[model samples]
Target: MRIYLVTPRNPESFWTYDRILPSLGKRCIFPNLSMPTVAGMTPRDHEIVLCDENVEEIDFDVEADIIGVTGYIVHKPRMLEIIAEFRRRGRFVVVGGPYASLCPEDLRGTCNVLFVDEAEETWPQFLADFARGAPQAEYRPAEKPDLTTSPTPRFDLLKVDQYHAMTIQFARGCPFNCEFCDIIVVYGRRPRVKGVPQVMAEIEECHRLGATQVFLVDDNFIGNKKLAKELLRTIATWSEAHGHPMYFNTEVSLNVAQDDELLELLRAARFTTIFIGIESPRKASLQETKKTQNMRGNLVDNVRKIQSYGIQVQAGMIVGFDADDESIFEEQLRFIQDARIPVSMTGMLQAMPKTPLHERMAKEGRLIAESVGDQFVFSNILPKAMSRIELYKGYRKLIAELYEFRNFRTRTLEFILNRGRQVGEGLAIRREELRLAARVLRDTVLSTSPRRAWFTLSLLGATLMKRPAAIADALAFAIVHKALYEYMQSLDHHLERVIGEIEAATETMTAAAVNA
Candidate 1:
């Protein structure tokens, strides 16, 4: 039997980083680890082929008995479209992932089989039933599986060199209930962790496959602090034994800063970056969202302490919440700049399906529409403090200002200068990567514009002069931010057109209502 796994590509988003990948001569930011993992779970006798639509085009003509597809918010429409084509070609379609787990009804009729929630338990069961010429239309696990039983993701199945980094997951859940987040809703709040040996073996597989940079794709890596430390210690030992080949990064709540020893372990384990979801600094907003972990400490101080350990922070912030006002946007911008978070993402509040925020908004009759995919897009929920129009406008302004050249440069410089940088012993930066990074920076300066060129040259040249060892990593940062700045410009242009079209349609509706 031939099983084809498809990862629907995100056309335009910060996550894919497709716009930035070309300059670095890499195929994609990271391979969709979910597809490969699911492929691994299937019996080895079956011929499993994985295609990431972001990196390569989907071969709709490919022959396969079963087609397994997965994706998140951005991939919903694309998945539906792809499923239709498969069904027409007389193929069986199975749909599952974060989007399907929460919004199963969306694909009810489209999929021949639906596997909601964790597939670790349900996948094998479905395969057995199908082999016997009998399969359920839908199969959801009665409870989250013990993550320890999870199989190693099929890293060997991937085209290793195409990706700049490989990804693996160490844990399954987050302890805190952030109202808008869907992680807890899908994988319970108890934080089911993988055993230390399991995680170490996965990393070793990545290392063996030539993956130097590995991302721990857990929503919050330290949800179970004790388990996290154990994993880190094992990772440090394995990385050392393997000659310090694998560097790691992941997301953690702000509370990770409180544990000084944990931070040391992460650095010793060769973690160069961490993404903190410091939603908002406003006490009222944090309280409203139930992100209680962030409220415990001075947000700015926590960020600084974490960065001081040589693990630079890439923060995630939100602008649309019940307590948010017009002032919130500027506050977010100011806080990010002050905190020296060089790479921060600001998203409008979106009440994802079945999340606490979604339920509350639906009860209040504030949810005007249900079409939400892109994080940068407006929420279906209407804000109590502001209009939908105001929310979109503020979000656009915030993103634009945050990525503005001068502000971006200032933030980057501040972050690099103050960052508690990890020792270079574990880093395996290749000479070719350095040269490609240099070309991207050089072109951005000489070709982008005189002002941009000057800023790029001056800022990077100074950093290289002071910290020559930072040249490769700094160049990688430069490549990312430059793409981000350009992507922001494109978003601005797209949003203006969309808003204009919306206004025109609204006026037409009003005119029609008056005539009626």
Candidate 2:
């Protein structure tokens, strides 16, 4: 049977960086790593082809016996559109991924079956049943599969030149039970990790494909400390032998600061960047969300300690928690600036389906809608401590202040002042990386001449003089900062109008009710 895999297009998310894609000449950061991976699990006899809609237009006219599609909550509408179109054409549609696994109701009748959960076992079973002419309407696995048995992802299916970084996964699940996160809910909190050889094989595959940067897209890279350290040791040895071509990065909890050996292992592994979820500075909010790991001790000191080890920390922050008050906006801004995090992706907290936060909001009758995955959009639940308007207003103020050109530059300067670690050896500046940094520098120069040009020039000179090898990454980080700033600016402008509309509509309803 002909099998065609489809990844839905990413919407205008705060992190989408659609505006900056042209600057880098890339279609997307990377094609959804899941589609190509699930494609690998399909039986070898069937003709398998995959298309990431972010890269190319989907050809609805293309003939296929079965069409496979994947998406998260944000891509629900697009996935439904694809399923409808394919079903109209008399082709069976199979839907899976995070969205389908957590919220199958979103596409109940649009497809023949909603394939929920991991595809490793389900895909082969579905193919066999299809071959026998008795396919089920849903494929839900009772247990997660062993990562060691997973196939090498079909990276060849991707257009390698179009992405900034190739994505790979070495592990699944997070050990922590943060109430707001769906990771532990979807995959258990035990943190199932791939064997060292399996991870090395995947990285080798990435190297073979000419990928210079690899993102180990684990929710928590250090979730399973023992295995993670073992993997890191293997990566360190293999990367050195391979001339350390691929600069790796991933997400891990803030408690990574507590482990000196793990930090050294990560540094030795040449992990250039890591995203830490410092959700909120409010201790009450952290406690409320059960993110005790972030509140273990002094948060700022933890961030500084991690940075001292040389891994660039990209913090994931959120506002609008039930325990948050008006003070939260300024507190978040102050913490971000103080922490010297060059890239802090702060957004309104949304109650995701199947997460504890969602269930709590539902129980309290505060859930207004399911989170559509829009970071800039309104929260899906009613704020317990503040009005929705107040939350939106404060959120707008927080991001606008934090991401402004002057504020962002000030934070970068602070990073330079306290910058302790140097880039790991053998991670050479590739032509592609340099070109992106150059383009970003040019853009910054064009927009920055009127103010702070001299300061930036001097800073760049110092950074280069002090850490020339790290300059490329520093500039690349500037590119991301620029994207986030631009996104925040646009989000502020649009959200203001949306807030006004919401208030006006509310006023109209109030007036109508009083008249009645």
Candidate 3:
């Protein structure tokens, strides 16, 4: 039987890196690890093929007995359309991934089969039952499978060159219970990690397949701190033995700052960047969200400490908490600028399905809409201290000011100045790096945005003069700035439409109430 595992096209957003892909000569930021991972779970006898719609179009006409569809909440509409098209043609469709796991109700009655949460067990079971012609309509695993027993993702099936990086997961679930986070709900709070040999083999496989940069795609890389440190040590040794063929990036909680040895190990393991959830700068907001990990010490200092280990700290920031008022926007702007985080992914607070935030918002009758998974677009939860319109306007202004050239330039330079010592002589420069440098130089020189070009050049200069080792990272940051700036410009128009819809809904509800 022929099987097609498909990842729906990602909507254009900051994470998509749509604006910078052309210059970088990549189709998408990276392949969805879930698609390849699900492929690995399929029986080897089946003719399995992986298609990430971001890199290639899905051919509905392809001869396949079963089609598996997966995506985040943002890709819900596309996933539904894909399933509908395939089902209309009489092909069996199976749906799963974050969206399916978090909100199975949304996908019920749509797909022929739905597998919710951790396909490690249920996927193979379904395939076996299907072969015997007695497959079930849904497979919801009651237990999260052991990561050590999980099969290596089918990275060989991916068009590795089409993506900016290859991805692997060393662990599942985060230890923290951030109220707004859906990871804990789906994967649970107890972090399950893969064995060292398994993780190393996967990295070796990615390296063998010519992946220069590997994103460790763990929700929180240090969730299991002891195992994480052990894994990092082995990775460091392996990288040294292999001439450090690939660098890594992953997300971690802010408490990673407290572990000096862990930071060193990460550097030794060739981790160039680690995204942290510095969700909000306000202490009250942090306490409200149960992100006590971040409130342990000075937030800015923690960010700096991680950066000092030569790992660039990218951040996930949120706004529109109940504790936030109109003044929160400027506060966010000032915090980001002061923190000197070049690429702060600032978005409005989202009440994701199955999360504590969602439950609280629903009980309080404040949930205005289902989460679209793109927080930058809008929030689903209504704010308590201000009108929804005020929240929208403030969010728009915050994003705009945060990405302004002057502020971005200041942060980039400050980061360059304060970042910690280099780990090893950086990885051997490749031809692609040379080509990307040339493209950046040419494009910036001929660019319409003089301020942006100057920002790029100034950063390039700073890295070269102070931290020559970080020259590649400097170029990457410049590209990120361009992507964020252009995306935010488009986002402004989208937000206006959302604002109109909210107003119309409010007016209709108010009118109905008056009639009643």
Identify the leading candidate in terms of lDDT: 3
| Tens digit of per-residue lDDT, candidate 3, span 1-516 | 899989999989778888888898899988889988888887788889888899999999989889999999889889999999999999999999999988999999998999899999998999889999999999988788988888888999999989999989999998889999999998899999999999988899988888888998899999999999999999999988887777799999899999999999999998978999899999999999999988898888888888888888889999899999999999888888888788899999999988999999999999988888889887888799899989998898888988888888888878877787665656577787899988877666566477777778888887899878878767877877888888999999889898898899889999999999
Task: Please give each candidate's TM-score.
Answer: 0.95, 0.95, 0.96
Tens-digit per-residue lDDT, 1-516, candidate 1: 899999997777877676767776778878877888898798899999998886789999999889999988778889889999999898899999988988998889898999899898899999999999999999999988998888899999888888889999988889898998888998989998999988888888888888778999999999999999999988888777767766789999899989999999999898989999998989899999998889887888889898889888999898778899989998999999999898887887888888888888889998777746677755677787876667777888889999987898888887777777685542666776567866787667666888777777767887878776666555666677788888888888877776676678778989999999
lDDT score, candidate 2: 0.83
- Which lDDT values do the candidates have, in the order given? 0.84, 0.83, 0.88
Clashes of each: 3, 0, 1
Clashing pairs in 2: none
Worst 10 residues of 2 by lDDT: 449-458
Q: Which stretches of candidate 2 lie over 4 Å from their true place?
A: 423-428, 446-459, 465-469, 512-516
**Residue 384 Cα positional deviation in candidate 1, in Å, after optimal superposition:** 1.7
Candidate 2 lDDT tens digits, 1-516: 898899999987765788778778788887678888887787678888888899899989888888989998889889889998998888888889998888887777889878888988888999999889999999988799888888878898888788878998988999898998989877889888888887788788878888878999899998889999999998989877877777889999999999999998888888968999999999999999999988888989999888887777899999989899888999999998999898888889988889999999999999998787776677888898998889999998888888777787777766765766654543555787667767776765556555434444655676678666556645655666667877787888988998998799889999999999
TM-score, predicted candidate 1 vs. hidden true structure: 0.95
Ranking by lDDT: 3, 1, 2
Clashing pairs in 1: 310-420, 310-421, 445-453
